[model samples]
Target: MRRYTARLLGFLAVSAIAAFIGAGAYVYYGGYDTSALQQHSEPVYRVLQYVRERSILARSDFDTPDLTSLDWQHAGLMNYETYCRQCHGAPGRAPDSFSLGMKPAPTAIAELARKRSPQELYEVIEQGIKMTGMPAWAYRLNQAEMWQLVALVKQIANMTHADYDNYLVQAQEESPQQTETRPRRSEEIASATELPTMEGLSRIDAGRVAMQQYNCTSCHMIPGVTAARNQVGPPLGGITQRSYIAGLLEYSDNNLIKWIRFPTTVDKDTLMPDLGVSQVHAEAMLAYLKSVE
Candidate 1:
């Protein structure tokens, strides 16, 4: 019995090691295509869908607002036109050509609305799904605006293309300025500088959210953030221990804030753009950077 048990353990250990080595080789050899043009395999797609659904279900503990009012629905319609239509498409419309190219392409919003509860929709709109090109709108849209978006989504499934067009026309007439133009990036950055203090979140947490909002991960590899592996700039894992900011300014809270808000002023030759980070947000970002090590 002892001999048999010893043999069984040895086989299990060998199998585990072999599986690990195979996985490593597969990764190292680039066994899978990662281009957005390539779709996920059926098994991988199903697994990801399952995980996404479960994650949403687990976190969708929101209390739905009274979304039955026409006022709320109209507000939702306008917001949808501004923020959602480009990616998710509308009744009798297709998503933008660029969005159609996304791997695991943006899901049909009408279908999602038809199947999911209001709370589920709200959570998705507010928090966003990671790695799926969905952005968390919490930083951009206020609570009421997000809830209004949910209200619009709830009504989308029933609307035909004509119905949507009619509603959109009415919404446009009601709020001409709201849907007529989108805010520019410079305006957005300037507004961020003047943003009121964020409630509930710690400084570091707020900073992390600010990092995402500012698209910092597109250039710098920040610890504890996803899709932050771009090598355009230096990795920030040990930024706190580093002697300098942007290899010019000495590392300190004031210097870091100045660099973050006005990178061009600090280094005219550097590629880093001035993101107009707020003093509060800069401090928050600094706190997160210091804590990373």
Candidate 2:
């Protein structure tokens, strides 16, 4: 019986190793459709769903603060309108046209809120789910602002279409010109505890601010910046140590500066866009990137 059991275990281990190697080879050979246009197969979706739920549930053990204030809800409304409404539509609204094309399309905020606790909502907001289009807002929003979003999500669960529309109108009236725009500096929306301006900061510090201002965190995993861990582009860490910039220009401060300021000029096919970095800002950013080692 002992020898029979040992043989069975050996067979099982070999089978598992073969399965893993086969899966890897399948992926390596491009047998899997990696397009965002294709939704996950049911088995894959179920596994991902299980992982997502378990991960959120395990990490979302913190206590949610008092979210009962009208002021807080209004703040939440503003944040929702600015950041979330386009993807996760409200009761009376449909998500923007582009969002519909996303595989595992953005879920209804109202329905999601009903299914999830405030703690879970806060966790998901602060730490975005992987393999999902959701981006972490921790770099852009303070703890209070994130909580405000949780409050808004909770309220969204209970609101009617007319109620949400009225809330938007009231929120707009309350803060007539306070909506945040993409091109605006991040400090404008930052909490009072944060530096109001980059004026007095060192060049390196200011460069870090400039990175956030230009929304570089949306793509690259930048050092010295929270929630800047997106893998859409190569990480900026140890960039100074690299032998080349974009594998075209030899590594040098001037070359890097040129790359930052006018990426398209150097390599037109690069996914990097010309963000129109000024000379001073480019130098400052180079200083910060140099310090990342």
Best by TM-score: 1
User: Could you give candidate 1's per-residue lDDT for residues 18-124 as a string of tens digits?
Assistant: 99999999989999778877888899999999999999999888576688853555777877877888899999988878898887789898898799898898888
Error of 1 at 72 (Å): 4.0
Where does model 2 exceed 4 Å of error? 1-6, 70-73, 179-184, 189-292
Candidate 1 residue-wise lDDT at 169: 83
TM for every model, in the order presented, reads 0.81, 0.67
Tell me, what's the RMSD of every candidate? 3.7, 7.2
The TM-score that candidate 2 achieves is: 0.67
Output the TM-score of candidate 1.
Answer: 0.81
Q: How many collisions between residues are there in candidate 2?
A: 0
On the 0 to 100 scale, the lDDT of residue 219 in model 2 is: 88
Give all candidates' CA lDDT scores.
Answer: 0.80, 0.80
lDDT by residue for model 2 (134-230), tens? 8766545667888888888887888899999898888878877765523323334532343223446897997887686567899899988877479
